[model samples]
Target: MLAKANRITSADDYRVIVRRGAKVAGAHTVSYLRSRESGTDARFGFIVSKKVGTAVRRNLVRRRLKAVCHEALGDGVCDVDVVVRALPSASAADWNEIRAEVLNALERRRARASIDAASQKGE
Candidate 1:
């Protein structure tokens, strides 16, 4: 489990990230990332819908996602809020597969941010 400080717990917070954040989609997961100016730690939220499976499978997917995010984020302090939503396919995915997908989504988000920054600077 992620530390409380590093977890997004409010519905409003999730809504803000989902509405205003940059998004990256993988085969089994979609990630939304929003950078904040005031926060000191990166926060993460997971969404495993009922469409993914029953209670047991949903919990399993959430746990796996949390582990993946912990490993990927490590102790990085970026003031970013991340929401990772698992698709139906995620229920069948292995840990490595889920990890890879989440990591890839994050990488894609980073790449897009850099490109956007460069373009803004060029303007």
Candidate 2:
């Protein structure tokens, strides 16, 4: 579980991240990330819809996603707000599969950002 300070708790914050953040999609998950100017640590939110499964299955998927996020982004690697939405396919995925998808998403986000930065610099 993430500490209160590291969790994105407000609906408005989630909306902002979803609307304005850069996104990366993998086979079983999609992640949106928005960098904050002042924050030194990253914060995260997870969304597992009813479409994924029944309450028990949904909760299980949520827990797995949380653990993946905690492992992948909990370190002070970047100051960003991240919202990870699980796809229906996630219901059947294992921990290694979920972790790989999450990491791939983050890496794609980083690559896109660097490309954007380079373009802005006219490089």
lDDT top scorer: 1
- Encode model 1's per-residue lDDT on 28-121: one tens digit a residue: 9989999776547778999999999999999999999999888866735366789999999999999999999878777776677679789999
Q: What TM-score would every model get versus the actual structure? A: 0.86, 0.86
In model 1, residue pairs whose N, Cα or C atoms come closer than 3 Å (at least 3 residues apart or on different chains), thus clashing, are none
Query: Which tens-of-lDDT digit does each residue in 1-123 have in candidate 2?
Result: 977877999999999999999888888998999987754677889999999999998999999988877887654446678899999999999889988987777777667767978999995
Q: Where does model 2 exceed 4 Å of error?
A: 113-123
lDDT at 119 for candidate 1? 100
